[model samples]
Target: MSAFGAWTTAHGLPAFSYTMDQERDPRAEWDPILEPPTRRHAVHLGNRRITLVADNYGLSGLFDEHTALRWLTRDTGVTRVGELSTDISGSERIFGPTFVIVRVADDQVSLERTVLCPEGEAPWVLIRLRVRNLLGEPARLTLTEEWAARPAQVNLISGTAPSTGPDEDVGLELELIGGARPRRTGSGRLAVPLLLAAHGERVVELRYGLLDDTAPSFEGSLAALRDRLPRASAPRAPEAEREIPWHAALLTGAACADGVLGGHTLDQGSCYSFRHGFNGAARDPLQHALPLVYIEPDLALSVLRNTCAWGSPDGDLPYALGPDKQPWTDLFRPSDQNLWALWLAAEYLSATGEEAAFREPVPYHPLHRAAPVPLGEHLRRQFRFFTDVVGRGEHGHVRMLNADWNDMAITESGVDRELMIAQGESVLNSAMAAWVLPRYAVLAERLGDLVTAAEARKLGEELRGLVAEEWNGRWFRRAYGPGAVVGDSDMWLEVQPWAILCGATPPGRAAELLRRIEATAAAGSPLGARLRWPVREHHGPGGVGTIWYAINMTLIWAAADHVPELGWQWWRRMSLAAHANAYPDVWEGTLSGPDAYLAPETDRPGRTWDLADLGIAMQAYPVANLHSHSQPLLAYLRLLGVEPFSERAGTGDGARFASRALTVGP
Candidate 1:
């Protein structure tokens, strides 16, 4: 049995726990057995930001962009019956919504250490150590805490940066409460002595404050801050699937913050290679907020508005927003960024039924300084940009500016990037636009915008027709460019399911394509579907022998209606439990996983995969809280038939779009 399963059964607590007792391969340079399993949670209040990471051992690090500090060593000294000893037993970790509890127990005493980063602008993380004397006789104990400051780069590129910086002097303020006065043992070390009666218990609290310009001084007691911490509720699911949504919310919630470029924005991810805090992606927040629409509608709406605010006056959206909210205009030049706005707007409206929100005025990008326009106008501008500015190619498909949803699609060998950008067309984006544009038109018509509604429907129909023409009798061609047609011989998993989901494929053809996908993409994998069959030898990232959560989740969404059993099966295969089971010794895949997983065919099966040209050796990024979490949660909801965009808006069927509100337990 897995450590989590054993822990849950032993404690009978409705919490998720993972123990690090599994043996790993000795040859692996990064040993999961010795390395601590870490979880990083972000606390953002106004402009101040602090990220705290607690591992199974204890509180590991507290950091921001400019500061990083962690406990170097924790030693416990216990004297019982006039005998002094210095030894500690192994530890077990339990993960709560906003905190982690690391418990260490022995014959003499039981020590439970809880680390919490409370929400709001407080610049401190609270550490509570509860000690209970297990012996019948009185016990004298001393706890020594040692801390050191590491280079800030250690935390900065905790995401995907190539290297770290030199160690620098960073200051940390430690305030202790309810313990004997700490004696200075050595530089960056303190020893606290405590006397306990027979079978007595005592609690010690430490507030580690960050010394940064953005961080504000603590105004209340640590207990008060703990009391004020927001309580989160997890959505109800079957016992087997319950933890999925809970952990999804926990990770995605850590990526979100207020007082960003746009109010209530979400970052791409929170830790490891995914750590791009303060940097926002236009497509990521939309996908991240999809599941949130059912859990937290108001927050989801705010995210939608925030994403809309990232649009320029010319209706062009940035691939990403940097720390200062500056647009990274030329980053990959993805053509599908603007289309996501329309897709999300449709989902938001269907889920909330808030027609009036479309009329609310929202400012354009701060770079433009343009007058605020209605939310509906922002979406219309996006539609206009695609239909008028970008326009269709000779084949009537939408223009692929550098790339589409597959950022690396145009980067394959022998393909001229410039030529592809100038004339390439994305069938995937065309299919997506075909699916979303009509739905958006339905919304536009409901808002009494007849012209836009008609225009959207027309373009959607034209794109659908163009996409259908690219069908290669087996699966739809991936894209049209200077190089050989992508996915012509080998089926590209990304676009095939989309064609079915968007209703572009005929009913019979959709079923045929799905069956083919199951036989090729789905059948070849032990954990979820593969990106393509007979893996591409000279392909870019995501081309072959990889499974991206975002793309496969779409497969689940599409299969839910047609292949119900396959949908659930594929969903389970992509789940955290499945990854944990497949790679019990890999810490990154045990608790959380990367955005994409390398298939069994790859050199490092069950590990993370990205940047195919860089080789698999360089792309095994550690697990980070990413939109991968949100995609599975959203797909699960879809599998449960909780679709927000099922009903066609403004269709003469007289059926109003309806949505079921889902709430997490508190």
Candidate 2:
């Protein structure tokens, strides 16, 4: 076993251990767009995203809107131990929730490098290198580090014209402590001298990050930052299951704290290859903050407040917030945006029991100079938007204006999108509203708003009946449209779980639907469940026969509500261990993966960024830090019997463990 394996075993966590001597790919090339280095781990804090490759190479650069301004690559930081001539060899790497450890050793000396980006308001990365002497007699050692810093810009989005921005000076800055004064050997190079007693250990600390105006100053000591680094508090579960929450924390934490958006706002993720590091989605921040309510309630509350601030006076939310902190609303009109805000506000209040939050005044979008309103008023506007602005269809289901949760649902070929947007109805959104409104009504009643509470309960009951009418004997239909009904013949996995969760399906019928889902959708892929069964081709990305992490997470939640054993089984199937075992060649699958996975039948099995019909073979959007990370964290909590809404409604206890141990069943 490697050092990482030993550490994981000692700590009761699963190990994704690698020995570089055998696993390192010597032929791997470096290209940010087409063939970037595989097996990479990134750390994020405040406004910076730093990546380190598997073979101890660093992708050192300053992040911009579309790509990175490179200061150095490949040999970003090369360190030599002993005699200043001996090379460091025999490397091993291990990944933790928020950190990565790399160990290299020679016959006379050993070095362990721990890299971390602590959680705080500063944008910086810390590298602590500990070197130990193995000789019986006192040894003289010299440490030399070198890097070639040449500033150049690389465009990650292929075939598009490069974006021009303001000219700014950006480079890598380094500060070293606990060693002799560093001597500048050459350009972008520093050498530190050290002497150690026999079998003695010495520590060298390197604080290096981007030096730009966007980065804030750090007044605290390096030791203070290191001490505040986020550590994983293991949940009570099987040894293999403990790593799920740890991975969830790392991915969620990595996507948070984009100071440009808001102090507590979360970006999509730090996956530069995917071009999602800097933007914020209206619905994503609410989902991403769900896990934080348990770990950090104050930060979670701040996220709720910041997300609510993006609402307009008419209660419409922008599709997404750009890197410039501007709203993008010209693309599509999504009807499900406000629904998420209402749902999250209720969840936050239920989990924390912070009734005082309702009275806190929050401003509208900065573009609108309207007076601030109480948080409760913001939530009420969201509810009214659904009831008035985006009114119901003829069938009493929520209007699908352009699209709903499935962005690609009404975007198929040969369909008049305008007509469909005007008349289409989404059963998925209806089920969600049916589930969210009544629960939110309880909170409203507690806050002494009887009128809104009564109105909410009436609307919720009406939508539930409308949803029940859409059942097609076997399962629920996805949507109602003029051209052809979706999920009419084929079963859509997204809506069925929601139907069971919201009590729209009868008890016996819900059980039958879940069993059929297990036989079809869940059986489609060995890696959890597919989005739909009886795969059909569509126009663009994420058509059919795909396993989306966000959708499947809801499946786990509903399954845990009815059948705990089956829920645990599906949860294990979607585990990182399962992904690694299935696709050993894909590096991201082992550490982290994209938001969705192509089914086994696709050309790129277990991989993302496959748009073959559009003449794009693979665009290299590999890294994902979206709801995929957050939903799993929420699902795991649900499996542990933490149902906040139910607990607050006096139906169950919040954050309590299940009556018996949950184990994987055959």
Candidate 3:
């Protein structure tokens, strides 16, 4: 069944939409416009961005502070809006409110505009402006399009100087088409009359682009813009088939000028920083690449190769892998990253029928000695480090040198290097290891390494059993720390779900554990699920009861593990959050995109556009990879006995109900 049909049947209908009508006649239906310089209602097109708030203003870059376009009334030489009433709408084109700006004066010449990010990499924004004669008599309406080059040094190495007086000469240029030519001022401002009509209604197609090598033409640009809308408005794929187009668009947006992937912050055409740089994250790109390998095999292969290519001498993947690497906390090496590499490599082989990748050599250095090893051999070495080296602890789980995914350190000093073994074993990381190792073992056996395969399978089973012991009858304890469980006082929602995904949770106890999660971790908030239930005084960096997309995703995976209906609910909540509603079209609580992590419950519905929110939003796009072929909607479909990819032969029962939509085969 179509995703829309299923959604409507299950949840009535989607509460959000794009069309909002003011007063309509045979002449025109004045759709609400997003006012200028808006915080929440902004549509990004390439580097050019337009915020729909009280005024029709825009800037360049995904989430930049530079004001590239500001609305000005040319007829009266006035800027900004007078008075307004807002009606919000959301669609696949953009997710925000549409607005109608009233002049609030004697003239009362109202301007209605709608902005959208047209599909394509061309650096241009599309805005539809409609001017109406609201008064009894005809009115002369002329709106000015202002373009200015503000002098601001963002991400400058030597630090930015305070704005010297306005006399600090900055070069600016402007080109207007399909409207009256704009006049340029020496102060880096260009004003163009956008709408000039004294009749029933006048519509102007405003296509604006930043300065580039080729001048943008109305015909070429407009054609490109119109072509994208059809695809964006194409029939919604079925539940299990959504990710195909979803990730394609997201990955297209994720492309950097330097040919690398970065986000969870910023959007398409935005500059990359230390946080979301090409070499920034060793694990994030790999994580993104896991499910992505199914569609964009070459792109996913490149990301995996980049991670493996940049490994440290000890086969340790750094926390960040960019040219200008900046680690969030360098105290502990991330053991999970290397494991992720092996898992991805195994997945790559499973997805594609290519075995040349296995024989391909990758550069490595364990003791700073330069040597290249085959890709398969490199992955085996990394898996050994993950298990034999970093996986050491008295608790028989992976040792938390500093932090796992939770990063739940109880002290200001972070995890002590000397006391790491004594502190606790990472149940989350170990559980993941328990899950991925068996898959890796299968790959090894296929590659003629029976010894490694046998050993990995044995260790994987042992680790799975060890992690299962942490199940405290209700939910799994966070970790086995010194003399006690670290988070035994309350549930750390992040780690518990992994046992379900990794096949460590017993069948009899799985249902009860999910119930506990729903009661504690997922309760109280419509912002999906929190990382924990009750807030600890200072739960360290991961913090107490903060909402993270990672945990929310795991919640869906666990829900898919047992109850498909629960998975659908979580997916609906995430969809509602993205569409600016919690339930239906009723706009009440917080309107947030799928962000990296919301602040702890103490902060309530935290800032919407912070920390990789777009990255999280991409996961909901249905095509973007969520690791293990495990998209929430796809998992639900799988639970409903639907096989989207029934062309291939199934591997085993383990492949039957796993989160992965694509099984291990070519």
Candidate 4:
């Protein structure tokens, strides 16, 4: 049995295991034994990530390490026999629910280890190991941890070593009930040795902390971690209890403090780092907060409040918020940051029926800021920055002075008084305005701010009209700059879907628009949809090209705009694209999540890399990459002729803030 299964069975839970039989081409680098635990085999409790694999390799990631302690020498690190075999006493076993424990037994001994991470704490991982000697003679074992080095310093303190490295800091400390601390056995090698009597058993635990807060006493931190062990190994309830799909539990969990995340893996580490800036990018965290509003309301509120704390008094949300709660404005003035903030607030209010949360006093404000205002006032400040401050382009649409959602869409335009420039009017931004402004109006009206509600409704209508004008029957254009209309040059994929979502498309036209989108944007590939069409050359990763999972998700979301069945079809396609068998011989991802993007549909030889098997495209939140995957639920409800937020809005849907209002769809 796997170590996880062993633990689960030991705890009275039934264990189930399976293996996929497939013929492998000798040239393919992917090893069947090395496939990261299938999603089902992985157990993630809160922010703790524990995955069980079939071999002593533990997890085949950049920072991956097998659990058991081995004998160490000056010349060699850890010894390994190729693959697990059935011969003699040699075999690998897996354990249950989320397979997080693995047991490997040989003629000489049996060893098992369980991995876990605790919630709302330091980014730390814990490994618990149990070993029993099988030979008649006593044996001495040396436990070793190996990962590629990223930073320079390694400190050992009270069995708690906090190491600082580049981009991220990592600390690994070994704790034993009555054992010796790790000693430097050879050049750059650290290990702890223990001798076991014939047929004797031993247990040891290792704790790893990322971004270790050295300020705390080591004993205190160690005790806190120890307190969490029972909860980690306990037979916890499934994520399905929250009404989410089992497969999507990881996405929702990671959005909050309860999820276990692999600490940032550096270039020097063994596994590729899927760094979607934790300290940077206002949009990233907000995207994570989207679905979280539905599942974990308080966590959602915390994310919103913390982000707005870094907002400038002028109403520009910072592109990056530092740990000090300060804003980083010099890198780029993100054009779309404020919109995401507003959307987050609206979604939270809609999902939780909590107007008082908005009315609560603002918890944070940057330096030179005025006395604290209520959250509602902060939101209005952001809207005013949008209306009175950030002016429209020549086409009367929102300007992409710095950059919109597409960071690469930056222009050479210089800055203005607001520290923003007018590069062009983006249809995507304008459509987003049209879609979200009315929602904001709904929110304002709910909060009894009639004047703000009227203003938002008026602006939303005007922007919706402009977006409609940009739709030339076949597809909506991308944007209009100082002298030219983009996407009119060639049908681009960015703006049309948003037009449908925002109700800018005429009632009878949404379905046709979706059909046209499918034909053009997804024309080249069978595996999935491309981000755009007519691949604009020499634009770097830009133009109507490349298969980005983000764009595909948006398109699927658009598909659900009116027709539930259509939306389901696209959703199924997206899910299938992530599967290894979905392709003839290639496995896209080692785990059960979509890759960042597939290779360009045109490249036959390199097409194999498009699947997640390439490793570099591995991401933490693929489901909510560009926009939150929760968007589809809203669309699905609409197709069923039910307004998602209608129940939440209640009878006060007309003008008053009700405790249970829902978004009404036409």
* Alpha-carbon RMSD of each model: 6.8, 5.7, 9.9, 10.3
- The superposed Cα distance between candidate 4 and the true structure at residue 646, in angstroms, equals 4.0
- CA shift of 637, model 3, Å: 7.4
> Backbone clashes per model, in order?
3, 0, 22, 33
Who wins the TM-score comparison? Answer: 2
- Compute each candidate's TM-score over C-alphas: 0.80, 0.82, 0.63, 0.67
Give the 10-residue window scoring lowest on summed lDDT in candidate 2: 657-666
By TM-score, the candidates rank as 2, 1, 4, 3
Instruction: Give the Å error, residue 469, model 1.
Output: 2.4
Residue 405 lDDT in model 1?
Answer: 82
Question: Looking at candidate 2, what is the lDDT of residue 565?
Answer: 65
Q: What residue pairs clash in candidate 1, if any at all?
A: 159-272, 159-273, 233-665
Q: Which residue runs of candidate 2 sit more than 4 Å off their true CA positions?
A: 1-15, 20-75, 82-90, 134-140, 145-168, 178-189, 210-240, 270-280, 537-540, 612-619, 648-666
Error of 3 at 415 (Å): 8.4
lDDT of 4 by residue, 1-666 (tens): 111111223223223222322222232334222233323222222242221122222441112211111101111112122222121122243333222455667777676655443344334444556777788999877655432223322111111112323322223332332346432211222344658899998776554334343223333433443332211110111211121232223343333231111121001111111221224466656655664554455666776775666566667776663322345566556666777778878878776778888887663443654666677887888898887666687678888766777655543222232333455767888898887887788788888999998998898889999998887767887776666666675666667778887888875688887776567666545535555565543222343345544555556666654654555555444442223334433333222333234444443311221223322222222222322233333322333233324442222112111111223311
Residue 529 in candidate 2, Cα distance off native in Å = 1.8
Query: In candidate 1, which residue ranges exceed 4 Å CA deviation?
Result: 1-16, 21-50, 63-89, 119-124, 139-193, 209-240, 270-280, 482-484, 538-540, 610-620, 647-660, 663-666
How close to the true structure is residue 73 of candidate 4, measured as C-alpha lDDT?
A: 11
lDDT per residue for candidate 1 within 1-666, as digits (tens), equals 343332252122234574543233232234221123323221211112455554443435554432112221222112122232222223566755445567777678877766665555454555666788998989888865445544333222233332224334445655564436532222344556879999999877665555323322232333333342223221221323444534443543444344433445655543322233234458877777787676667767777787888788778878766544556664567888878888888888887889999999888877788998988988889888878877777677888888788777777523688888888888889898898898899889978999999999988888888888878888898887764576787777888877887777787787677778878877757678787776655323556777888888888888777876677678778766677677664555555556677777776677665442332222334554455567777776676666656632221212121223543221
| Alpha-carbon local distance difference test for all models | 0.61, 0.61, 0.46, 0.47
